[model samples]
Every structure is written in C-alpha cells, then in structure tokens.
Target chain A: MVNRLIEPTSGRILIDGRDISKDDPIALRRRIGYVIQQTGLFPHQRIGENVAVVTRLLGWSRKRQRERTDELLTLVGLDPARYRDRYPSQLSGGERQRVGVARALAADPPVMLMDEPFGAVDPIVRERLQNEFLRLQEQLAKTILFVTHDIDEAIKMGDLVAVMQQGGELAQFGPPDEILARPATDFVARFVGADRGLKRLSLSRVGDLELQTAVTAHPGDDAEEARRRTLADPFRYLLLTDDDHRPIGWVDQDDIPRSGVLTEALAIPMSPLVSRRTTLKDALSMMLAADVVAGIVVDRTGRVLGLVTVESIAAAMRPPDRGVGAATDGSGPDAARRLAAELAARDDQELGRTEATRA
Target chain B: MEAFIGVFAWFADPANWQGPNGIPTRLLEHVVMSGVAIGIALLVAFPVGLYIGHTGRGAFLAVSLANIGRAVPSYAVLVIVFPLSIAVNRETGLFDIAFVGTLLAMILLAIPPIVTNTFAGMRGVDPDLVEAGRGMGMRGGQILSRIELPVALPVILAGMRTAAVQVVATATLGAVIGGGGLGRYIVQGIARFDYQRLVAGALMVALLAIATELFFSWLQRRAVSPGLSGRSVRAYENVAQLGRVDVPAV
Candidate 1:
C-alpha cells in the first residue's frame, strides 16, 4: 500500500501526514528504497550500473552516477574495482543482496521497503549481512519497513516491530522490547514464542547496566589480601588482573594460598570476555556457559571495566517503556516479572535459569 | 566429382558474370527483394510484438499467427498470393507482376517468426526486473526501452535471423514466378538441362543463406550487451534458433 503496488479497497496509508493514495505512486515510490530477496538486479546491466540504477533514473549526471555507484559499493563492503564491471550472475547471493541494498540506497531515499532481503543467504551469511546492515543503519538511519516471516529476525532487526497476522491484519505494533515484554495479542505472544523474556534480554546491553566492582588483585600481589577482599564481596570471587588491568581469570577465595604472592598460575578458568555493546542476553548466556556468577565487561582494549552479574540481566527484562500497551496484555508482563524475580533470587552458579523460566 | 568440376567451370565462365540476367545482376535483384521484404516484415511485426509482449495483451493473437505460420509452407503462401498479383497493381509503386507476387509471399512468410520471437523474448524478461524498474519510478516507456528492449534483443534478433534465412531460401521460387534473382540460374539451368548452372545456383543460394546466419550471429554479438549473454548466450542461441533451416523448393 505504501508503494501502491496494489490499491487497498479500504483504509489509507500515510507517510508524513498526507494519504499516499492521493499521491502519484511513481513519484511516491521514487522517494523510497526497495529491496527484495531475489535482489531483482538487471542481469543485463553491470554491477556499477545495477547499484546506481535509481541514481540514473533520477537523471543524475553520468559522472555522478559512476561516483555514487563506486561509493555505495564500497560502503556495502564490496570492492568497487573488483565488482563494478561484473554482471549480477557473477556475484554470490550475499553479494547480490548487498548490491540490492546499495541500489536501494543509491537515491538516498528517506524510506526503505525491504522484503526478506537476507532470507536467500545461508544462516552464517545472513548473520554477517544483518550485522553489516545494522552497522550501516547506525550511520545512515533511513526509515526501513523490513518484512520477514521469521519472528526472531523481527525481534532482532526492528526497533518498532509490526507483527502481522496470516491475513495481513496488524497483530501488534511496538518496540521489540515492549512487544517481547508484553505482547498485544495471543498470536503475537505465540509468534514471539515461549522464550520472549529471554529474547528481551537481547534488547538491553551490558553498557546500560550498572556493573559490580569485583575484588581485583594483580598477579604479584599478596594472595592473603586478595582472599580477604574476595571473601568481603558478596560475589566471593577474586578477579585476577594484569599490570594493564586486563583480566587474567577468576580465582576462588578457597584456592588462594594464605600468605604467598598471587601468581598468574593461581587463577582458575577464565570467564567469558564481554564488551559494553554485548547484549545482556549474550552476557547471561556466556556467564551460564562457564558456570560462573558474572561476566567480565571489557573495554575496546580488552581491559576489565567491571562485572555484569545475572541480577542485571534479570532487571533488564522488565518492560520499562510502555504507555497504553501496559494495560492490554495478559501473560507477557506477568511472565517476565516472575522470571526476572526468579532470576534475581538465584546464586552465581545457578545457571539453570533457562530450564526454570518456563512461565 | 565430374558434376562438381562442371559447376566450378560454370563459375569460371565470364559470360555468366555480365548482362542484366548475369550473376551480379541476379544477386543484386535477390538481395534487394529479400531486403525490402524483411524491412516491411520488421515494420509490421516489431511494434505489434513489443506491444503484446510488454502489455501482455493480444498474446492469443500472436500465438495463433505463429502456429498458423508454422503449419503453412512457403510454397503454399506463394500459391495463395499468385492469383492476387494479377488483379490491379493493388497499390502503386509495385514493379513487375512476378516481383509483386513473390514480395507479397515473402512478407507473409516473414511476419510470424519476427512476431513470435519478439513476443517470446519480451515476455521472457523476468517480471521482477520490470517490477523493480517501476518501484524505482521508471516510467512505462523507460521500462520498455531501457530494461525490456536490451534484455530481449537476442531473442528478437533470433526471430529476425530465422525470418531472413527462410525468406532467402524461399526466394528461389521467385524464379518460377518469372521474377529475377539467383533463383533464375536454377530455373534456366533446369529448363536448358545445364547441369553446371543448376548446381552453381543451388550452391550460391546455400552460400548466401550461410552468410545470412553468420551475419546475424555477429550482429547479435555486437548489439547485445556482453553482461547479459556472458555465459549462456551460446545455449540460448541454440534453443531459439532451432528449426530455422528450411529446404528450398527447387
């Protein structure tokens, strides 16, 4: 309806404030970018021409089209020199999808309509493309109405997700965290699946949480002092740090010798290393893998900042961003509340929260 | 071997090279008549094919015409137009009665392949490409010219190639209609029982037909973008150019 590919029998679609049904569909679509699963590249055209199709359509000069084509290809991580002259048949599925995105972005349209653009590639390639597109989205920030059948993809890609039922009826429209925390309908609740609370864990990042300061000791420091400090903290684990403050590993308080200097060999197995941008869900999963209470949060240089415990991840599960949506839902928020409370009560080694959060 | 020697000697005879009914005169006559017929066929079939192919309208008509063309023989069309040529120089600018009959027959014979192939090629273009073009705000004319035309060129040319070859081979019957062409050599050689001229005429027609096929192949390579035909062009040519060769009714 946005592009008016098929006219609606009822209802109007508005872009800014005006109904697009009244607007010239050709002109309206020109202001939007479009990408599809097949990539829909003109097989007769070169890669450079395919990327710059919209620019060429918009009457840009030949020189400008060439420059923009090269620029967009490079932005999408394809080397313009290598790929520009090749045909669509010459590129891989992933490369063709990138060109589809690049072509859509060619005219710098304010709105983008993407229909399962990454669905054609294998899972690993899809993940990489999704990450690359997300990074690019951070910079470009174009409004995208992405369509996908996979609910996991919806939860991952969309900031404001519109869950459509089987007949194109709007089931729910809200932010990913909100919908996950509190789905509008049973269809949506079922659509997001039983693991919606765990899915919501992906929404909040480690940087957003106030991490705990674990008891720290250098390799050459006194083991007695380190043991005392570890015993004092509620976590009861000494984080071994190097001279650069980069974490070595975790050390149990009982494992520390009475009066000897703390050596590098005294450290037990390492906890998973996490960065600030790491999702709370991933952080929790990583902590669960090592059967530890905490994940060491690191900076870009891999220097330890602080520790994110299970409690922080549980706290993030709450839907803090609802207005009218708080009243309509039945099971989502209540389930999330019970799971978060249950999670908050567990010990650091209680990584069995996954099996317990059935509600 | 003896018959082949006589044909070579016929070619070496300078007498066959001169005069209004000579080799050069007859060859020019053959090319002009066939060339004019092809031009007219193109003018008639090309637009109708594109219109039907692009709009997806009148497809039944194109299919029916193609089927009818395939079912009817070249001699049958020439026979059908045989009576029509004697009537009144129907439209002005027509020169000679046999030329009129043969030209009409050639034009009729040429229409179906050009129309069928053009329609097939145009419709063969992926609809996704057309949709993408429209979604990108390309106008109807722009889509047809820029996307559909370039992509469908090989198929369209293949149709033309078939039509041209068929017309060249069938033009041999123009000599039976009392018209001038390389066909005259075969007709006169047969009538005079001159084995050499008869073989020579058949060989010359065969050579012209081969040259037409190669010329179209080169033209297709030149006209179509390499990107489109980069890998499967040879395969596509084999598929589309099938059944084009017709044995002349000598």
Candidate 2:
C-alpha cells in the first residue's frame, strides 16, 4: 500500500502551475519565504543587518541588499529611518513582528508560509496587523500558505483555505465561502463550529450581494407626490433626503397629506446605516443592534447606495446541499473504498511503528 | 593613605628599578609567568568545556569535577604537585619544577567557571531559536557553530573574565613555590622585611588585574552584539525613527 502522505495525496499541491512535490525541495524552499510562530530576529544584529541577512546569503549585492531592506521595511509599514539601526531587544513586540515580515519579504520570494506570526500579540495589534497584511497581499498577490488554528482568521485571510486535521492531514481544501457554507465532513463542520452561518458573512463581501436602488425623495417635494412614490413602491417608507443628498429620515405613506410639502410628517430618526465596505458580518451586527430588518448601504459621502434585507442575508447564510456522492462523482463507492483501504493499510504500518517505539 | 603615597613614590624611583639580586627582573618574570598560566588555563578549559557542553553525557561529571578542583585550594594543589615534580626532577633532572607546578595549580583553578558557564550557556540557548535553525536545514555542526556558539558567546566570555581574574589573583601562590613574576618580589620583600618592594609588587598585580578585566569586558561587548557595545547612541537614534507612520487601519 502507498503512504497516504508521501504518495499521491487527496488534493494537488501546486505552486505557479508546478507541483510542489515535483521540484527539488531545496529549490522550492528558496522560492518560498517561511515565517514561523516565533519572530526569528537575530538579537545580536542591527535591524537593517537582520533584515538583509537572508538577502545577503542569497547572493544579492550589498547595494541591492540595502535597497531591498529599505523597500521591505517601508512595505511592512515600518519607517526605515527609525528602525534600521535598532537591535531586536529595543523594539516592541509589534515592531519586531513587522520586522519579521520585512525579513521574510526581503528576497521577494513568490510564495510565503506564515504560521501564526501575529498569534502572540494582543488582539488590537493582531487585528491591525492582519488588516495591514491583507492590504499588502492585495498589492503583492503572493501565493500565501498561512497556517492558523483560528477559523475566523483563516476565512478572512486565505484565498484557498486548506484545513489541516490531526497529524497534519488535509481535511478540506476549497474557497472559504464554499467550505463555510458546505463543509465536507462531520470533522470539518465541528472544526468550523456550530455558528458556521455567522462565520460565512465574514467571507462574503458587499460586492457579492445584490443592492436595492432606493427611491430618493427630497424633503421639499409635494407631500402627495412623495406619497404617490411611496405607495407605488413595495417598500412602505420613502427615503427623505435634503437637496445635498444628506439622508434626513423616512416618509411613511400613512403620515403624508393630500398636498403641501412633506417636512413635519417625515420621521427624522433613521435606522442604523453602514458603509459599503462593511462586511456582511458587520452589516448583520448593525442590523441586530438597531433591531431592524434591513440597513442602508452608504458611500463615503453618506449618500444612500442601496439596502441590505434579511432575505438577502439569509440567502447568503443558507448552505446549498452538496450530497455525499458529490465528491465521489463517477468513481463509484468501490473506487473510494479501495483508496480508503489502501490509506488505512499505510496508516496501520505507521501506527505499528509508533506502538513499537512506545513499547 | 599617606603611607601608600610614600611607598608609591619610593617604588617609582628609577634607582629602585635596579637590584643587587635582580628584583625588577624577578617581578617582570612573575608577571609573565602569571600571564602564561592564565593563557594556558584558557586554552585547556575552553575546548574541554565546549565539548562537555555539546555532549550531554558526562557533562555533570566534568562540571562537578571542575567544582571539586576549584574547592581544593590552589596552594594545596601546588603542594600535592610539588612533591611529584621533585620525584620527576630527581629522575629526569630535566624539568623546570616551579613552572610546571604553578601551571598545574592555575589550570585547576580556572576550569570550574569555564565548564559551569559553558554548560549553562548551552542549556540557556532559546529552544525556539535552535528549532528555527534546524528547520532551515542546518545540521548539528552548523547549528552549534552558527547558532549555539554565537548566542552562547557572551556567557562564555563572562566566564572567561571570571577565570582570568581568579587565575591572576591565584598566581600569587606561585611565589611561594619560588616561581618567577611580581610574586617573587612579594615573597622576597616579606622574607627581608622590605615593605616598599612588597607594596610595589601588590600594586602592579592589582593594576594588571584591573586592566585585564577592562580589556575582556570590551571584547565581550563586541563579540556578543554591536548594539550592546559602547556605540549604542547610533542604534538608539535609529530606533527612535522606526515607526512614525499614521495609525494603521484596524
């Protein structure tokens, strides 16, 4: 029987169209930057020297090393002028982590392996660092293999989340939303936690959902006209705004008179509103806080963009049923059983070795 | 204080540099003997201590034996080695007895600190750092040389400092065995009741010890970390300028 880990595994591990296993591990390792759990800064060296150490080892010129160090320091959000000469002991934990990242990015390797680099820091710093990394990844587009135990963090960070089970076995590999919505197995579901629907929103962006074009009614418009617009629309409330497009309140159909301006009848108090950039998670939180069915999505100028309803959110939360046979496809139960039996046989041999060592 | 100054003045006199029995020469010989003993002790201890530290087996035995060596007074070791040398000298009639005896005594005195410090330094290396080095594909030799030795260097140097001062102070024991250096002046001055010469010899040893310590301390600072060196002002300036960006978006 073939070893499950060393043999052809469940999923293909690729880097830039090349199989990770096919290449020389040494050459592959050089192309990939790895940052471990601890910030591996050499305490004896200056910050500039520490950042440049790997680049120097990689045979870069002294001039190129200096240039790359400065660029990465700036890229990791550290002012090169301030931190370049300091030792590791002098900097705060957050600063050291940024320096760690700068060191990893020094050679500009196409791939990065970060294993809980920010796990040791406080929550506030962790969040800021995570967001900063997100912004950096957006700019660099490096293929990142980030190993984190935090499911929320994995959902937020990974473009393709590969959930690892006990003994470093891959449990599931897919887009974050797909995994959160439709977990592959019982282990995957439990690992993702019971509140998988709420976790799904963290992966869903505002761009993914359809936005409602709100009916705009000026506060100075004729009351009957505003009433007509409100009555014509399925929504009972007409969004009342000033001439400058600043949202004032809503005009209910019942409160409008037959004629005259619609001012006093307008309810000045509005429900909670959130920015367009707000995650569906944040929008849901706002919706819950305001005890409202929907929230107004506004731009930076506070002009109304659209509405987010409970139906749209619920639709996103619902997991489309992918039956058990979805993975099996045309390869019948016989083939899957054969593969599992081969894996089990290999696992037995390894297990026997482990037991013998214990004895 | 007045008496010391007077003695210092008398010792400073150029005429006193000359002696009927070559007192100045004996004092210079004593200084050289002490320096040689300390250097040999360092050579003997550093490698043995490093090997014992790297290999876990027999480390406790080595360190405990070193402690026992330290506990046995230097004079006691000298006395023990002196009789053995007398036997060798009688048979061979070829060896310098005093030099051999003084070296044995000084080497025994220096090993304990080096062994204990090396063991502690090796154990004190950050386990994560070792794992990091290993994860980077460094083998045992490379890890010990590149990672372990460099990190343990400061502690090892500190141990050497202790050993140097200890050996230098203990070298005075050689004068009792008639081995040359300031100790000979000290011994002669005592026997002849020459207070000025004794004071001069003591002053020289004390000054030399202080100078050696200062020199090793500077070397230790340099060998360990450039930032920890006396030139920390520039490093501090660089640190102050490190992170002055706008508040990061959370």
Candidate 3:
C-alpha cells in the first residue's frame, strides 16, 4: 500500500504528509525502494543491469548507470568488478539477496519496503544478511517498513515494530524492546513469546555495557609479579597480552611458577574475543560455548579494551527504572533485580531440600 | 528400381533444367506460394494469439479456431474457396480466382499451429518475471517487448516452424486449381501416365519438405535462448544420427 502496488479501499496513506492515493503510482513508486521475498531479480539480465533497472527507467546515461550499479553493488558488500557481468542464475541464494538489496537501493530512495527479503536463505546466511542489513541501515537511515512473520527477527530488525493481527488490523506499534517488555494486548504478548526477555538481549550490543577491567600481564613479564597480580584478583587469573595489547591467553595463579618468567607457553587458550559490535546475546553464547564466565572485549585493531562478565550482561537486561538503561540505550536495572529474585528463589528451594533431608 | 533410375535420368537431363517449366522455375514457384501463404497467416493470426495470451482472455476462441482449422482439410477449403473467390473477384474486380483460392487453402492449413503455439508460448511466460518488470515501473508495452517477448521467443519460433513446414507440404495441393507450383508436374504426369515425370516431381516435393524442416529447425535453434533450448540441441543431434542412417539408402 505504501508503494501503491495495491490501492487501499478506504483509508488514505500519507508519506511525508502528502496523501499518496492521489499521486501517480509509477511516479510515486520511483521514489520508493521495493524488495520482495524471492529477490525478483531478472535472470536474463546481468547483475549490473538488474541493479540499474530504476536508474535506466529514470533516463540515466549509460556511464552514470554503470557507475551507480558498481556503487550500489559495492555498498551491498559485493565486488562490483566480479559480480557486474554475472547473470543472476550464476549467483547463490545469499548473493542474489545482496543483489536484490543493491537493486532496491539503486535510486537511493528515502523510503524502503522489504518483505522478508532475507527469508529465502539458510539460517546461517540469514543471520549474516541480517547483520549486514542492520549495519547498512545504520548508515543509510532510510525509513524502511520491514514485514516478517518471525517474531525474533521482528525484535532484532525493527527500531519500531508494528504488530498487526488478522484482517490487517494494527495490534501494537512501538520500539522493539518496548513491544517485547510490554505487549499491548494478550495477542501481542502471545505473539512476542514467553522468552521476550531473552529476545531483548539480542537488541543490546556489548558496546553498551561498562566493561570491568581485567588484571593483565605481558607475556615477558616477571612470573613473581604476574603471580602476585593473579593472586590478588578475585578471579585469580591474569590475562596475558602481546606487544600490541592483543590478548594471548589467561594464566591461573596455580599455574604461575614461584620464581621464573611469565612466558607464552604458560598461558592457556582464552575465551572467544567479543568485539564492541557483537550483540550481547551472541557474546554470552560465545562465553558459554568457551566454558568461561567472561569474554575479553576488543577494539577494531584487536587490542583488548576490557572484560564483559555474565553479571554485567545480566544487569544490562534488567527492566527499566527512571528511564536508565531503557531500550534506547539497551541497559536497565530490572534484569539485575530479576536475577536477584531468581537467586533468592533458588536459595529457598535449597533450604527446603535440606529440611526435607532432616525429616 | 528401374523407375527410380529413370527419375534420376530425368533430373540429369540439361534440357529439363533450361525451360520455362524447368526444375528451378517450379521450385521457385513452390517456395513463393508457401512463403506468401505463411506470411499472410502470420499477419492474420500472430496479433490475435499475442493479445489472447497476454490478456489471458479469448482462450476459448483460440482453442476453437485451432480445432476448426484442423477439422477443415486443405482440399475441402480449396473447393469451398474456389466459388467464393470467383464471386468476390467479380464484385471487387481484383484477385485472380485460382491464386486466391489456393492461397486461402494454404493459409487455413497454416493458421492452426501458428496461433496455437504462439498463444501457448506467450501464456507459458513466468508470471513472476512479468510482475517483477511491472514492479520496476515498466509500462505494459515495455514488459511485453523487453521481457515477455524474449522469454517466449523460443516457443513462438517453434509454432512458426510448424506452420512453415505444414504450408510447404500443403502448397502442392494448389496444383489441382491450376496454381503454378512443383505440384503442376505431378498433376500433368499423372494425367499423361508418365512414370518418370511423376517420380521426379514426387522426389522434388519430398526433398523440398525435408529441406524446409531442416532450415526451420536451424532457425529455431538460433532464435531460442541458450538457457531454454539446451535439450533442443541434443534432440537435433539425435535426429541427425537418424538422418545418417537414411543417407546410405539415398
């Protein structure tokens, strides 16, 4: 309806405060980016010409169209020189979706309509495309109306999600975290699912948390001093780094020799490194998979910044109080409180178990 | 065996090649008549097939026309058109009666395959492709020309080939109405009870039919997209292998 592909029978749709019903559909659609689930790429045309469809229709010169095609393909992370001349049939499903995205953005329209654009690919590819799309949206900031039946995807992708019921009625509309935390109706709650709290973790990135400093020592450092540092720390472990400050591994206080030099051989493999851009959910998954309670956060240069513990991650997921750590910043105190309540409940169960044993 | 040798002897005679009623003249006449009839049929049926296919309307009309064309034999059509052509020529003071009657019969024989194949070909185009073209802001004419026509070209060419071969074979019947074609030799030889002329004429018509089939098949291969016509090339190879088996007998 926004692109006027289908006209509304009763209500009028306004874009930029102008009623679109009265506008010429072709002229209006020219200014809007439209992408469908199947990618809808023309198999007969090369990727370059497929991406340049709208530009050609708008009377762009051949030189300008070629340049724009390359630019759009490059923007979607496809190498223009390699992909430009290839037919759509020669591309993989993920590559086709990338071309589809590039084609929709060819005209650089202010608004984009994506209907499950990444839905056709496998799960791994879908996740990659979603991350790439999110990164692209961060730069483009185009007003996009994304439609998907997957609730998790809705929470992850939409800055503001509109939950619609059967008969095309709007059930709720708000930010993803807000919609997840407080569904407007029973249907909305059921739709968001019971694990809404866990789903909300995906929206927050590790960059949003205040990471705690981990005690560190250089690989060439004196073993006595490193041991003292490791023993002093509550975790009793010291992270070893190279000259560039990139983390090599961790050394337990027990593993530190009493009178020798700290060497690379002494350090054991560390948990997976989490970048600032890594989502909190993914970061936690990495930590769990590595059987470690904390992950080292690194910068783009791979230099260690600080450590993110499960406590801080859980703290960030807490419910909002005084608008601090709300969905806007992906931090809240409610998650910490919820964690405390669960711990207390566990303790009660443990106490009851002991009493039953005595009886 | 003796009759076949006599036919070969008739073709070898230089005098038979130089006269007004020579092999070249008869072959040229046959080709022109078939070409003109096919051209007329294309002009008449192509638009109707295209329109019906693109709009998805008048499908019943296309099917009915095809069935009717098949039911009416070319001989019956020629007999029916003879008196109609005479009356129309008298009223309009135009059109030679014999030529009009013969052309009408060949045209009726050619329309069914052309119209049926063209309609089926256009209708078989992927709807998603058409929708994609429209979604990209293509006008109706652009979609038809740029996307639909190219994708449907192979099937349409197949239909044209069918019509061409059928018209080439059927044009021989024009000799019955005094139309100038290679069929004239056969009709004259039969009337005179001359076995050599009859065999020679029959051999020439058969060769012409085979040559027309091969030419259209080559044309079809060139016209179709490589992606769509992969199996066709292999199918042609199989037919060629069969042709090799028949070459020894010749």
Ten contiguous residues minimizing lDDT sum, candidate 3 chain B: B241-250
User: What is the C-alpha lDDT profile of model 1 across B45-104, one tens digit per residue?
Assistant: 999999999989999978897779867999998888987886636565456878988998
Per-candidate total of colliding backbone pairs: 0, 8, 5
For residues B1-250, write the lDDT of model 3, one tens digit per residue. Answer: 8877888899999987977789898899899999999999999889888888899899998879798987887789889888987888899888877778788888888888888888898898888777767766777897887677767877888888888887887878888888878888899899999888888888888899899889988876655543344474345346555663111100
Shift of residue A145 alpha carbon in model 3, Å: 2.8
CAPRI-style grade of the A/B interface in model 1 = acceptable
Best by lDDT: 1
Highest TM-score scorer: 1
Higher-scoring candidate on lDDT, 1 or 3: 1
Cα misplacement distance, residue A66 of candidate 3 (Å): 3.0
TM-score per candidate, in order? Answer: 0.87, 0.82, 0.80
The residue-by-residue lDDT of candidate 2 on A1-359, one tens digit each, is: 01111345466676667676776544455456766676877666678977875676567899999999999999998899878877787788888889888877777888787868887788888889899999999999887778676777888888898876656657789998888877886557666765788888877766578886667788668888778888888777778877767677766678777899877456646767877677888888888888776778777888888777777888766656655556553278876885676565665545543333222
- The parts of candidate 2 lying over 4 Å away from their true place are A1-29, A167-169, A244-246, A322-359, B1-6, B9-15, B19-24, B52-58, B83-95, B134-146, B226-250
Query: Candidates' DockQ values?
Result: 0.49, 0.21, 0.23
What tens digits encode model 1's per-residue C-alpha lDDT throughout A1-359? 67887798998788878899988888888888999768889887778888888888788999999999999999999999878867787788999999999999998999999988898999999999999999999999998989886677888899998876655567788999788887887556666776888888887899999988878999989888888888888887899999999999888888989998999888888889999999988899999988987899999998999999888677666556656666434467787785575466445213222222211
Cα deviation of B97 in candidate 1 (Å)? 1.7
Indicate whether candidate 2 or candidate 3 has the larger lDDT: 3
lDDT of 2 by residue, B1-250 (tens): 9878878886778777786435467556656766777688778777877787777667878888987887887779889888877777788888678877776777778878887887778777787666555444345786687667877787888888888887777777777887766676678879989787788778877877887799889777556754444464354455455743221110
